[model samples]
Target: MSNDDAYDNSGHIPDAASYPPRWEAEALAFRHALGPRAVTNWSYGDNVRQVFDLFMPEDPPKGLMVFIHGGYWRRFEPGIWSAFAQGGLDAGWAVVMPGYTLAPEARISRITREIVQALSFMAETVPGPIRLSGHSAGGHLVARMLCGDAMLPAAVAARIEGCVPISPLGDLRPLIDTAMNADLGLTEREAAGESPTLLGRGLDVPVTVWVGGAERPAFVDQARGLAAAWGAPCEIVEGRHHFDVIDDLKDRDSALMRAILG
Candidate 1:
């Protein structure tokens, strides 16, 4: 594989091809099981991609848990991660999974703004403490929310309880040399400015960086770097890889879920 190709994780996870459908199937079933409890396609912006799926229990929610799907900022949507809402739903917390405009069509900064819009809308609509978590590129986006440039409203920003960036690319500079940059179109300044590692302890909310033990070294290092920079903790899911490490979000009783809830 080309050096750039190596940096693109789509080629690394052998089971990557299977996860979309698996998540889709699980999400569909979970939605069906939820019936009236689930709210799908809640729009936050004018763009078609600016929407989210929210799941809730019978009682008023104690808080909101939002999961951002990862596809290097260019692939996948919220539908594939809806099943992950199950854990929080069972715990009496509302869960939200948002879809944002993809790369190539939208620049990274634009995507960042789009997510901020989504978060702002949800914070107003849901009206509760919000905890954010994401995988891969989604992880990067969650981290970006902590930056000063995100421009979240004071009321909305204060409602954020915690953040868990899983297998995040905290440093975007390396990605400029990767094959995905053709789609990402990141300039040097943008790469440096957008990097969580470079931003240096911008978050006021608590952060917990997570990665799979079996993930690429770069991914592990990224998690470690972000944790160290933010004075946060890093949790490595044993034997999981980039694609499957997020599976823990589906299980309400898992340690990952506990960490998020805590």
Candidate 2:
């Protein structure tokens, strides 16, 4: 599928999966290449629903980058995206990838709470300011954290220096009309509560919204809406799509990486 087709209001998942074949292959390869020593699982709650993984650097790190993976808040896990750590690690940054309970099993509110708990664990266990980033569904979670909620525990909120959310779905109203809501089960009230566009106006922290140039127009619109609502900067990664845009992070000189590190 083409980028334009992916964003069509067809209300279908298969329609929006136009990520480049090479990107998907690389992501899968990276998931398989993870070394045992580089990844360690950490639990935020009593059971499996609270688990996360820390991707450590070979040398002492300059700062921490917490990555939240994307699967429309239903599928995927931290393990599948561990390969993303290579970019941050090479740049002397530690990476933390966390997983939250999927919808149907848990509500959006609970998922948000689990993210907070995961970050709290990181604050208590890891050192230094944290730079947050996420893709798609994960993007919304990271953006929501920028609200600097005292509920997160003051210390954790204070250590969050910046946030970067790529191809984020900031508004939830449209999802209610789309077939995607089958698993989300988002009522109007719950959808409003979870939308970053609605929650971002009160946020005081710095944020950079990014979208791949080749991403669906809806994704681009989502990024634009978030940046406009928050009064922050929005960046477009040239010739990239929802998936390949993340590869730019591996290159320190890439504009998206510069925005994150800047």
Best-matching candidate per lDDT: 1
Best of the candidates, TM-score: 1
Error of 1 at 113 (Å): 0.6
lDDT of 2: 0.76
Clashing pairs in 2: none
Instruction: Tell how far residue 96 is off in model 2, in angstroms.
Output: 0.8
Q: How many backbone clashes does candidate 1 have?
A: 0
What's the count of clashing pairs in each model shown? 0, 0
> Taking the tens digit of each residue's C-alpha lDDT, what string does model 1 give over 137-164?
8999999999877888888888888898
- Residue 105's lDDT within candidate 1 is 92
For each candidate in turn, give its C-alpha RMSD to the true structure in angstroms: 1.5, 3.8
Candidate 1 global TM-score:
0.96
